[model samples]
Target: MSGIEYHVSLVGNDSWEGTRSAPLRTISAAAEMALPGDVITVHEGTYRERINPPCGGESDDNRIVYQAAVGEKVEIKGSEIITNWEKVQGDVWKVILPNSFFKGFNPYANLIQGDWFTPKGRDHHTGAIYLNGNWLVEAAEFNDVIHHEGNTMLWFATVDEQNTMIWANFGNSNPNEELVEINVRQSVFYPKQSGINYITVRGFTMRHAATPWAPPTAEQVALIGTNWSKGWIIENNVISHSRCTGISLGKYGDEWDNAETTTEAYHRTIDRALGNGWNKEQIGHHIVRGNTISHCEMAGIAGSLGACFSVITENIIHDIHVQRSFTGEEMAAIKFHGAIDTLVSNNRIYRSVIGLWFDWMTQGTRVSRNLLYDNYTSDLFVEVNHGPFMVDHNLCLSTDSKDMLLNVSQGGAYVHNLFMGAVSILPDLGRSTPYLRAHSTEIAGHHTLECGDDRLYNNLVIAQKDQNGLSKYDSAAFPVFMDGNVFLNGAKPCIHETAPLEADWFDPSIKFVIEEDSVYLHLTCQMDWKNQKSRKLVTTELLDQTQISKLPYEDTDGKQFRLDTDYLGVARDESNPYPGPFEMIGEGRMVIKVWPHA
Candidate 1:
């Protein structure tokens, strides 16, 4: 049911009624008059301001919806245009403004310092300078811009008690004549308070936010953040150019923000979070789908304790933390701290530091059918998480020195994945991670990882010539169960495995090509594996119980699940199907188009 329809246009009045005939001048004006179940339509123009929704909807059925006008270009930017510039030296320009020009939050004065953030021996600020449509790199020293020698553009700023001075090396182009913009707001769309829920944001181009270092322990203000809310739908937007994170369905600020870095400190912080309404009834339950998030200095999508029971699917997340100006522990394309019962599926994540990093307390989480490649560190990193999480039908296809899938956690089930890289498994006896009860947010227990409580089945791993695979689990503390896995091109299997299909001398030369609008995977192999070993149809009943959590792998409703579908949602054969994610296979040249291409 529609409550009201408000329209916002460039040539409109704030005093007028927000109808299409007499539209409002600003989106903030429409937001002020919009009630629950209202619809706000923004017309074609660039809106340069931060949007802080005052209130949320009463329920998901009656949520406030904000959308761009159909087929119209709408851009919401957090930066303002700056035209005043004085040419100082060759390719160098300077701008000086009063400190009060930045209102209350000055990105130039704010340093990027938070929990799990390393400055790499230099001070990094939250400010950024953009020329035309690209962002310039920040210089570590004032003399680095003064004595600059190449074609690279750099920006250096210094803020004092009276004024803030900024210097830029704009090569060949006059800064006063071109479109030079600087960050003014910390977020484009975010709530100032927590528990703002049941809102829908869609179809806008949001960019150029001077966001902060979004560690899981902090509030994680990003280009767009849910801010510990519930029942939010953030979809069909283009978000980019954040100094830190692009999108955050993440934590809210606390007294312990940026103060918990150690293992013991984080564990205590978790306890405090549990006391402060970190359950599924209040926080999380967000849906982030069908958006393009890119060019953030930190993770593209980040959540601390606020990503539980959420669905993040079909998003293209790339170019996260690619600058390498700083290093931290919380860097990835998709980084979540607590991912309890979250459904992360069908996303294409590439060209980041790490593809996915599922940190502590990731029980009942389902990561399925995602395509990850070109990540420098690793494809997927499960750090210190406990048992009963599922990973299925994924293609971990990153190449070179970064082609390693790091599994530093236990109690995991890997099924029908295509690993085109190496694999590493190690136990963590130091930091004891939390594990929730089955399909619930109540933290049942916490224990140090004992290692090798995992089940690996029907995975096809293709390691490089000298790299290794599941054989890394041969030295673990407990015994692991493995069956019907195909190891090729020097990828090894554990000695205790039963019916391991080993093809050492065969090199199925694989190629991933992106042409026009689709991504295709080309590989050549033999078809003898159809009758080599009989495989069981993997189900929750077959995966009886995880050692640490002692829970069977089931859905959020406590129902059993079966792996009867391929990565493309094609139906699999009932009994004794193929071993890999694809069911139908041939002896030679098989080229399949991957879905949700970037």
Candidate 2:
């Protein structure tokens, strides 16, 4: 097929031929006419309607490209501008809109509800009010907006069957003079159907979406989503102010998503996914990079379709899931389920509920070279997965000892990481988690007991005062291998196997360097493992030998692990490499390419 370039402008007519001079009016109009190998260049304007593409491209090379024209500031908004307003006493203002203004869907009437969504005992709409490009807090009650003494607040109520009434506190500014908008749509750019493959959306600012909570058990919704699609490249975009999720590379669950209320619903959803083509040919080979996704209620990037054989790198994701009017198990900056053979690298994630959460069936996955700090919960939470996985070269710092790392499952190798907080490996024996077959996405079986066979190698751990650098629960029965790790500032890691045991003291003759803000330990003597020789120095070769032989760190279609270089594009040494992420450039020194707030 011959490639064609389509143009869209604010002043053009939709009936015109989408040429350089005769451009279309709406992105939706261009999307309706776009075919494979088509490029839709949207001009600089605030487009309000959602761009629901009818179809996508046939392959990656012939993708349907939707990009901002050159360096133009193109904004695709899920909101519509509202101008008519009346002062309703004090700082509160009111606006009444006819029912015809909403077309068919009303986001104000659609309450945010889904699996694990908490409305705080009041109905919270997906709709929001933005005053001069800044989003206002949505009030659950009318009294909270009108009677409250705060900076600003907004509330919406249905006025009979003909109109909708909205009240907001404008803080002395007249509503007529400000650019006020309200969320009227669910998504700015999203496909109405699934399997929309090989699409590229770039260089656009998407915001003010009324998205719902995205759980692996439900039909995940986002401001912009690749709904069970393949080969989508969402890059170089600024996505913000989503009511729930920002970007979703996820599945479309069935009616069970709305009916089932237990954990078995997720298992059933997985079963349904297998019946449908949830294999390498059908699901997840997406590349999401160079995007800044922030101020989302749930997550910056979330997927339930496992994101199998995908690459999510170099994205700046922050301020996610921070305001917790609602809480659940699936809240994080980047959360995914069944991330088989996927690479999550070189991303900066901070100031979120949890940083990176790899929940269930995370086999053959690697979390490497990421900078995570100032998260409320732990930076990394790997729950219920027996992995032959790797976490290396990450700089994980938290404000306190409670927010470092939480490893709930087993069979993980930690190498060359800087941990500036606490680490906990607690196994929940009452729950049995499922494991998938090696090299396949099919579930093999479930482990009835907690199998903790995690290995920590050459990591630099700096613990806070009066806190154990690394510790496990007392009742944990599995074995954890520890060797070549440096604990600074008189910090000792505790290991428990059938009984609790503190780490043996290092030789006092070895000179160590402890800085004011950081600690660098130079060990001249090995750890004193007198009677614990059987449990000490257990390498990655022992823990992951069987799984590695079977799986070999390959994607479903035999794509090898994509870690030839570190996060900063530095080449890694094949033989005798150093402990952490960076290869040492000189004697007694390593380079950290990406620093906090750099």
Candidate 3:
């Protein structure tokens, strides 16, 4: 049976019965009135309040769906406008507020501290100041705010026992005249309790949250998060301007939050989690799709062990950790720890620190059809994983990426991808990371990393002049499988390839540019390498079994996988396909739109 419908509008009262004509004033009130199978529709205009759903839906079929009304622009934010500012110095302004004004949790009083977070020789706060939707960089101290640099918008805050004081360099603008705001709340739409399941949040423009540093061992809450829940769908939203992570599908709160700093301590975290419902039925399985998440200080999406058996697809995530105000270990567009059987596909990630980071226990995970470009760091990073993982049909065209594929792990299959960057292979004999069983979260075994058993097949590499490619893997600890690969533009091949095709004399002129929400590739390429060396269609039999896990390259259900499809889902030739991500294309002076195709 269909459940009740609750309406929320800005001009409604909390005492009124929630109907279309008599809507409620707050979404939280509507959430309180809602139950399983209930639908809460928020009307247009901004709502400066937090939405904490007390309970959740029972199942996917009967979910508590909270959606913004169609054709109406709804904005949910965690900041408050402040017009009461006094001019302190030239281009600098100050605001003083009572300690009681923060409602018991003052962001100015809280430091941005957690395990693995680097403050860069100074302390930083969780609070932020914004002038007309743009954020100001937090200063390291009061002296930094006093001696403002040219054109740098900076803010500094100090909290005493009774009051909190803030100073900001407005950069030639009047803070009282303009729309200036400050961070007040920690998060916008986050459930306070763990194990909240089957909730759907969609179509709202959420912004300006004071989220903290989200470590793997902590109760990683963010601007929007599942909080160790299951089967949550966060879709079709514009989430931005977070002090840290934007969306967190991560671990729950316990005594171990920020307490487990070392690797051995983290293994104990995993062991305790395994005993307390860290399985397929209880955790992970969250779907974050079709959202534009940007301007977060930390990751766009972060998960420790709560992102398993999930699908992250069709999202546009960028500008994550781009400001570089500080340093940290966990900074990426999408960062996860144990991404077992997770499918990360069709996502566009760029302009971030790192694109995709599968940290540990990345077994049976599939990374396909993603467009990663112009990242500050590498496009992909796999650390300490004993994987049977697959990364295929991706456009990792980042000439600025020092190492496009930083595979510090082993047993990975890279197929049909176009790379415009270098590769790095490094062994990890320090930390013994775990690898899970096929399609399950149960820990099968653990070992230190071996930088070998990698398969680079049917791929194209166009590196910069004098840039290194797969030659770095020549001294790997174990043997690797390298075949059917073409290197161009001074790119080097591994010594292991029996018959490598190197075309340093020919310039492919590979470059991709964005125009009108489409990525266009411009190149002058050739197909002469096909006759020089035979290319085989990469399949499960060719990938075979990983050395450590002893599992074949297969789908999540243990079915044999096929590499018979290109990045655009075009059919690949079974006998002999072209060496790149494209099977069929023009040869000379080719300019084609290669992304966002139907």
Best by lDDT: 3
Candidate 2 per-residue lDDT, tens place, 144-244, comes to 88788856555556545888899988887888998998988888877878888989999999998988777788778799998888999999999998989
> lDDT tens digits, residues 301-322, model 1?
9998889999999999999888
Give each model a TM-score: 0.98, 0.88, 0.98
| lDDT, residue 586, model 3 | 47
RMSD of each: 1.4, 5.4, 1.3
Clashes per candidate, residues 3 or more apart or on different chains: 1, 1, 0
Local error of candidate 3 at residue 235 (angstroms)? 0.7
- What does the lDDT read for residue 235 in candidate 2? 97
For model 2, the superposed segments whose C-alpha errors exceed 4 Å read 152-156, 449-451, 473-475, 494-543, 546-579, 584-598
